[model samples]
Target chain A: MVAENKGIEPGGGIVLDGISHAYSGRKALDNVSLTVPRGESMALLGPNGAGKSTLLNILCGLIRPDAGRAIVAGVDVSKHSSEARQNIGVVFQDDSLDDRLSAWENLEFHGLVYGMDKPSRARRIDEVLALVELSEWAENPVRTFSGGMKRRLEIARALMHEPRILILDEPTVGLDAQTRAKIWSYLNQQRRERDLSVFVTTHYIEEAESCEAICVIDHGKVQVQGPPADLKARYGTSLIRCLPRSPEVRQKLLEKYPEAQRLSGDRLGIVVRDQAMIDAFLSEFGSSLKEILIDEPSLETVFLAITGREMRERDEVNSKARGKRNKRI
Target chain B: MSKLTILGRGIYAIWLREIMRSFRDRGQLIGGVSRPIIWLLILGIGLNPYFRGEIYGEVRFVIPFTYLQFLFPAVIVLNIMYTSILFAVSMIWDREFGFLREVLVSPLPKWAILFGKILGGSTVATMHGFLVLILARFADVTLGWDQVAWALVLMFLLSFGLTSFGVILAARVRSFEGFGVFSNTIILPLYFLSSSVFPLDPSLTRTQTAATYPEWLAMLVQINPITYAVDALRGALIGFNQFDPWIGPSIIGAGAVLFFFIALVDFKRQ
Candidate 1:
């Protein structure tokens, strides 16, 4: 038992060690180990049914793993979950806000739940609301807030007590691209300003690139973990996108490159093996082609190379499986 | 002391949220206020004549009180039962809407969270019970300050027990859609079976009582814990007793402790 500072309240960032949880007979997490040292950011990248939520639940002290030690904020979670919860703030995958209450009321409730003193509660309420740019709408009920506003308020409420470790489970799932970008900027700013360690689970590959470290999980196992640049350079692929002028031209391109695959919007994509392939294609068909664009190696291409499937294609297949597991946790 | 203060803040926060929600809901408030008015003002007055009328051509009183006075405290109990037992709906709302997870991840213990919710529910129920006392004058029943104070304490205790029982119901019922109908089924049956609307003659011995009324009806009044709760309030406000005085207060006190423990156990498991 590692003693926390001053007394027995849990303190520090996440330290999940060999933590494994199973639902009846199905294993959701299998010998998972990860660490987010104090004041750092780590993104958990996984598709649906990849155990991201299960991992987040364990970190937030919502579920106790069947086998292994989870030391969240220096406290053994299975033994003292309440204490472990002290240093951890969670924005769950689902909308957990009480829409009936005002934005201020929700923040007030959060502060009190975390045992913030009256003055501090008042002070932090204003600070966090401003951080999310929701200060003017504090007294308005959350029911009237748009989805992006609700997401923003949820983030503000989670930061009310200034938790040492912040755990967000798919924090920006269904929002528009602009709102998604805004939320990420707020989170990045929070990380920079506070001594906060963030462990966010997300399937958005482009956004995951912003984290200091990335862990790609699939089938309840860690497929890879490293900085974004390293993972991209090693597993990522550059592709050439070409729109043929006619059926004859498309046939000729496919004949020359047998591996070329049809993409959306009448585009054909060919994985670039080397620089010579691009030179040969451009010289051969640059004038004849309707359009040609070279996509640089990115997290999307890295995900494709590692997982062997586009992230969106796996959505429907695993959703039912994920739903069954979600009910238990 | 520090730990206690922290737990206190957490409890107070949760309790305050429930109270605020109850206040904001116009529909629940209407039900709480109007329920007692209809039962006491109309039902009691309309039935007052027959409570003291001739029985089988023999002039007699059922006990010694008019129907209005006899039904007053039980009406308070009825009001409290409606508010407290249906407090489960609030729990269901929280669960269905995902609001419960916010507090579950906080530093508060499971027991504290449950206690705060039960406390909030009982407070609202007790207020509904208190609303009935304003009609004491209308019912032709006078009360001293002490009686009113004692009645309030008893009402609070009963509400506490019933609110905890509501939590037990909420834990069992998963869907919010069916809980209102399901709780109505439970509340109305329990209210009717508790002898809230009628009095069982206690002057006769148990065997004679069984012969006079249907055996099942007599048995149900005695067996239902709510019967004693109503009887206890009746004793406090109207100086009435249908059974041994000790039985009413004892059952109420015991039920408050027992049901709360059941709720706490269920809450911890969740």
Candidate 2:
């Protein structure tokens, strides 16, 4: 047994070793092992059914892994979940705030649950309100707030205890691009200012790019793990798109650039290993092409390449499977 | 500072929040109080002539005050029991709304959450019970200071036991519909079978009727913690037979503690 610390220690991190979990013979997480170093922001990028939420729940001490051990802030979460949870903060995938309560009341009640004294709770509530940029609406009922506002409040609630390790499960799902970007900026700022270790699960490939490191998981297992840029450079190739003005023109272009992969609608995608290929393709077919696009391989492409399906499609399939499983039970 | 103090504070806050929310819900507060008031008035008046008789050379009093004096105390226990069950149903809503997860994940001990909810529901039950008693005073039932104090104590103990039982049921229940079925299957039967409405005379055929069901039901009533509570209230408000004076209240207290620990264990499993 490790001794409990009275205060935050430097270089505190999370380590999960050989963690496996099953629900009614269906494996949710399969021997997943990962580490998040102190002050490192890690993104868990996965298609649906990749066990991201399961892993987050384990780290947060909400669910016990059926096999192996998970340590958070030097405490084994499964064995000492209450004590372990004291050192960690989590924002669940679903909205966990009391909608009937005002924003300030919600924070106050959460602080009380964490055993904060009145003075400390009041001060911390003010600080967190400012941190989430909701000081103006702190007294307003949470039900009246927009989705983005509610999500921000949930983040603020998690930060009330000043946890050393923060775990967020799909924090920005179903949000507008602008709101997502704002939340991303706030998280980045917090990371730099507090040097807090953050573990996040996100389906959005663009959000994954902002993390210091990324772990791509598929089918309840980690497929690849590394820095985002490094993973993209390793697994991703640049793609060139070409669009012909007419059907006859498109057929001719397709014959000419037989290497190009046809995307969903009227777009032709071609892998460009070097700038010479782009120049040659443009010079040869520049007259017939109505539009052209060039981009690096995205997180979506990396997921498709590794998982053999798009993230959205995988989510639909997983939901159907879950519905069937629920019916059987 | 210590785990105990942390738990204490958590329970206090949760209890306070529940009270505040219950008061805010106008329909719940009004319905909780009014249901018992209506029962006391309508049933007490309607059954007054029916209970007029002499049994075992003792004169039978009318229903409202005479019968109500006996029934009112039981109604107080019933009020607490019913309200606690209703509060348990609200737990289903809490589960669906994601609030239960928040409470479970708090740093406080899991038992604290269970006790907090039990305390909250019991407090509401006690309040409603008191309202019925005060309204009974207007219905011509006289009570001294000692009787009122004793009645309050018994009401508190009864609420604690019933609330603990409700907590145990709530933890086991999965859905609102399931809780509804349980409420119908358990609450009504417990109310009718117990010596709530009429006196328990071993010679009465009604007593025989209670005996015909099962040993468990008879034993439950014989040991029915609520039976002692009703007896204590009857002895205080109306002139009724009191048996095993100290043993009854003591047993009810013991039962409350037992049920509370059982509910706590169930909460930990959840």
Candidate 3:
């Protein structure tokens, strides 16, 4: 089977079948399964210890799953990691560039590790540096680069060998909003131009919303998976919020809309199915309310609706697990 | 390309990068070469009068060879030992900065990566040993070209063994501070226990054997592989005898292969 595809096909993608993993007698990934289609973007949304890292380790062939198989770009990662890894490129959450090396040398080293010859390495180094808009700084030490430029250079280094799938772990975690947007724009451009499959994990709901498919994981298990629009439509389409004028008005609003929740600081939040429902709600309680705000449901609301827990709350629980795991490792 | 070519290039690439890093850090390069030179100047000249004449004459049957001649190869061994070990410490830095992740995730095998680091470090340390050998002329030692060539080969073996030992220790260390403490605790004792600064089983008189030496110190010297390295180098640079000349190269040669395999196993586990 491995010999049949000595080289990965450009259209090949990733498949994780019942992948399970444990660290120090505690389950880190519990039968977690996911897929990224050829030439598509998929977000594995998880809080810190939500088994996202373990899953990624399995996919990269760094850690073997206890009870499942991971196939990357038509090769089984466990059985043939070198071949599988050849088809995959990774950008870790940690800073991976050697600070002492120039940007060109860093990429050149990566190219050589992947067995690219001198001419190809040179050509691809130039091409990748240009792609990330870092051609001007190619000769400068990576230590001298700004955080955003370093991140861009890391992306360039990951793409030096032109792998079929790109897996990024929280690629924009510490970046400012503008830099994050720039990174996304560059990633999207590359995904389109090269027809590359991107499997990215991020805590940012909005970032996941931009992907073609989303998988929400918590407590080492995937809570939900679907398109952002479909999940939002099924869970919540619109959010209706209002601040009441009086105690009697607040009581009446709660009695009329049973699902309405009291938000922080004297305001109520309710999930409405459509604009018509929001309009009907306003018509009925318009005068009783001091203010009303109605808008389309954000991914956060969808996440909250599906998981029945806030992202921050999940993060707190996962952080404790991660702390213990970190100490053990 | 054949698999052999790919593996060769991978190892070469890793080695090339480390060399580039070592050269670019000017303080590191200068420091690696200068520490031994300082020892050769200060300690060699300082201790010359005390044990100059009769000490080595009993061991080698040679007359008028000063303590500096005896100390030169020891200092060269010292240079090779510390430089290669410190070079292996970069593995911890690589982990902390996440550059190790790139290497770990590459198509290349883990053993190949470890081999590249070992080869790079040993070669650099060996070259640094050569640089320090330039000061040998000032020590009143004759520079036979054959002796110089022999010294380099012995230096290469010694450095390879030391670097592989360093890699074994550094492979699992996660932090620079941890590695620093571990290296200090291990390397200092390894150097002191070896004959890098003092002769192991130095013959005191014509008929006396190494049994006349202190029991515990003799045992330590016998067990220390680095003692063989220094002894072998002492033979290559000057006519000397403490043990059979082949003993040093053989111990270091076997030790290099053993430590390299151990490091490879440790790295693969990681």
Among these predictions, the greatest TM-score belongs to 1
lDDT of 2: 0.76
| lDDT (tens digit, per residue) of candidate 1 on B146-260 | 9999889889999999999999999999887678788889888888888787888656234335556787888887889889988888899889888888899899989999999
RMSD of each: 6.4, 7.2, 6.9
Candidate 1 overall lDDT versus native:
0.84
Q: What tens-digit string does per-residue lDDT give for candidate 2 at B163-219? A: 888777888888888888888788777776667765555544353346445656667
Q: What is the C-alpha lDDT of each candidate?
A: 0.84, 0.76, 0.80
Ranking by TM-score: 1, 3, 2
Native-referenced DockQ of model 1: 0.73
Candidate 2, residue A200: Cα displacement in angstroms equals 0.8
- Name the lDDT value of residue A113 in candidate 3: 96
Error of 2 at A128 (Å): 1.2
Q: Candidate 2 docking: what grade?
A: medium
TM-score of chain B of 3: 0.89
Q: Which scores better on DockQ, 2 or 3?
A: 3
lDDT of 1 by residue, A1-329 (tens): 65633342445566777888898899999998877766778898777788988888887778889887778668787798877788788898889999999999999999988888999999999999998999999999999999999999999988888877889988998787788889988888887788788998876666677888888888888888888999988987887768899999999999999988676567787888999988899889888888676767877666666665455543443333223322221
